[model samples]
Target: MTEENRLREKVCLLAKSMFDRGLTGGSTGNMSLRLPDGGLLMTPTGASLGRLDPARLARFDAHGKHIGGDKPTKEHPLHTAFYDTRSTAGAVIHLHSCYSVALSTMSGLDPDNFLPPITPYAIMQLGKVRLLPFFRPGDPAMGEAVRGLAGKRSAVMLANHGPVVAAKDVEAAGNAIEELEATARLTLLTRGMNPRLLTEAQIRDVVTTFNVEWDT
Candidate 1:
């Protein structure tokens, strides 16, 4: 098939995976990817990710006009924010993931680096996931909040909401978001036990070796 068709199918598959895994049940997540031809393929609003039809994906021009397909997700501004701020953002995924949202509200979670170095994989997969304040769903303030990061964070957790992640492509964006959720799960699972985590030096080595965006 063509490139557009491939991306469209990928979008549906990833969205289904998230929904099926309970990451974002119902109609809570939105996904969008920039096409090589300067267009966009996005999931439609009010559609459950678990049931997204590839043929119904919304299509938009490079100028943001709705050219075809179904209505775009209302979280368009949140998606556009990263695309505008991060030049490297080719695809963005926003999910109402459970653990990440719960972790966002917990005390002692550092804003500078939300997830601790429990594992080197988290460090390698997610440079630094920012924790952003909660905004009403579909509020443009979310876009502003993401912009405030100044293109530094690849992922951000919305208080009481879920996480939004951007990456070089749709697959990477989904992978990064999954890593965020997994780390959040680990954090919750080990809370109060004070589990032994990766040392500072080990984390530093991972960051330095992988050229990660650890601002520590």
Candidate 2:
């Protein structure tokens, strides 16, 4: 099969996996990838991740024109912001995962780094998840918020919403967002226990060893 066909099938398969595993419920997530021709392939609006049809996924030309497939997700701006700012962003995933959204609603989160240092993988997969303020769903301002980061962050937690992650590929993006949710779950589980978090020095070491994008 051609690479594009493979990608289409891959997108559907992975999205279905996430949905079946309860990462996101109903029709509350969107995904997109950068096509080799500089175009885009995206999930359609109002479609359940568990039920996406590969051939019906939205297709847009490099110039943002909808050339084929179903209508793109309304959060296209959020995806586009990452692609426009971060040259390395090959795919973007946004999900309304319960744990991450719950974390976003809580108080006293570090805006610059939303996820706590619970695990090294979280730090490596998602360097620093920026916590963005709450915006009404499908608001274009959400994209503006991502753009304001200047491509410094690979992920962001939308207050009262969920998490969005940009990575080098679709699978990497999926893995990173899942890590974000898992870390949030760990944080919530250990909230009152004063669990041992990685020290600043240790975190710095991990960042250095992994060559993470700790700062913009």
Candidate 3:
């Protein structure tokens, strides 16, 4: 099969995996993969990730035009923002995961670094997750919020919404977002219990070792 067909199948497979595992339910998540030739394949609007038809996935030209298939997600701008700002980003995943969304609703968290240092994996996979203020679902301003980070952050928690992650490929994006949710789950579970977090030195070491995109 051509590389494009392979990628199309990959998107559907990963999306179904996440959906079946309750990462995102109903029709609440969206994902996109950048083709080698600069085109894009995105999950269709209102389509359940658990049952996406590879052939019906939305297609976009390199110029960002929707050329075929069903209509793309209304939050297509969110996916494009990362691709536009981060040259290395090959895939973007946005999910309304439970723990992350719950964490986004809490107060006094660091807006620039929303997730706590509960695990090294979160730091290694996601340098620093930004916490963007709540925007109405599908609002273009959500994309603008991600753009304001200047590509330093690979992930962001949309307040009262969920998490969005950008990575070098479809698998990496999926893994990173899962790490984000796991970290958020840890943060919530350990809240008010004074969980021992990784020290700043350890965090620095992980960042150095992983070449994390840390924005000080």
| Per-model TM-score versus the true fold | 0.96, 0.99, 0.98
lDDT of 3 by residue, 168-195 (tens): 9999999999999999999999999999
After superposition on all CA atoms, how large is the RMSD of candidate 2?
0.6
lDDT of 3: 0.93
lDDT of 2: 0.95
Model 2: runs farther than 4 Å from truth?
Answer: none
By TM-score, is 1 or 2 better? 2
| Colliding residue pairs in candidate 3 | none
RMSD for each of the candidates:
1.2, 0.6, 0.7
- Model 1 lDDT per residue over 93-170, tens place: 999888888888899878878898888877887787887777999899999999888888888888888899999999
The runs of at least 3 residues in candidate 1 whose Cα sits more than 4 Å from the true structure, single-residue gaps closed, are none
Q: What's the lDDT for candidate 1? A: 0.89
Error of 2 at 154 (Å): 0.5
Query: What is the C-alpha local distance difference test score of each model?
Result: 0.89, 0.95, 0.93
